[model samples]
Target: MKRRFFCSTLFFITPLLILACNGPSDPGSNFSSGSVTPPLFAHSVKSLLTLSVIEPADPKRATALGQYLVWLVQIDRNGEPFPVNAISIDGGMPAHGHGLPTQPRVTAQVSEGRYRVEGLKFTMPGRWILNFTVSSKLGNDRFSLEIDVGH
Candidate 1:
């Protein structure tokens, strides 16, 4: 009886562990550029301005366990440049329940509605969520984006 119980428990537990490791957000596989279901590459929370990455075209390909720069363009609902006075960055792996490995920030404004993000590094291959807050004439708005990384 003890052996049968152990066998049944193991049989159920093994498949569950396998399924958990092979989930959509599995760190081993390379998923990027809004490829995840329901399109998580955009924002978890909406903002007055829409932020989109303009550089490193593919985040999964850019992942190398080092720092990198990511450029972003913020446009309004009408496709006009959002007047941004200040911007901040914060994000992390929600599954892991921690913040970004580094403190990334908006270093400069490349042009109207275009900003340069610096000091972004993904130490491990997994799903990461990035949050950006913009202070504009309208008000302070915060948004989020999910990116896949692999090294």
Candidate 2:
């Protein structure tokens, strides 16, 4: 009876003690969290489109604690400027399992293939996944990039 009670206490307290020392994690689950460095320019999963970040309208928006941000990017299909009818943005921290604090979207087509995205607000410093879905004349495709937000 004493051994059974001790075993039960060990099972429950071990996890808490481990977490008290440091948070628990699954190596496979957060594979991209701190290991991989995402590229500034990336190709779609199907390789049908190319997405490139022109620059942050203000460089500080990325590291600014509470400020919203605007971004300019160019989309290309087959290595040329690809105009799109619409672009939708969605993202979150996979480790935290929550979506973005704001619903960011493509505000305008700045020029041929260049687009303006706004309403990006990061609530915390962590590894965030930014996903862009492009809807165009040819077809629909998606671009995903991992962003390491700094404190």
lDDT of 1 at 52: 68
Which candidate should be chosen as best, given lDDT against the real structure?
2
Per-model CA lDDT versus the true structure = 0.69, 0.80
TM-score of each: 0.64, 0.68
Prediction RMSDs, each to the true structure: 11.0, 11.6
Which stretches in model 2 have alpha-carbon errors above 4 Å? 1-39, 57-65
lDDT of 1 by residue, 121-141 (tens): 887677887888777777777
Query: For residues 36-146, what per-residue lDDT tens digits would candidate 2 score against the true structure?
Result: 333457788778889988766333444355678877889988888889888889999899999999999888889999998889887888778899988888788889977
Lowest summed lDDT across 10 adjacent residues in model 1 is found at 36-45
Q: How much is 119 displaced in model 1, in angstroms?
A: 0.4
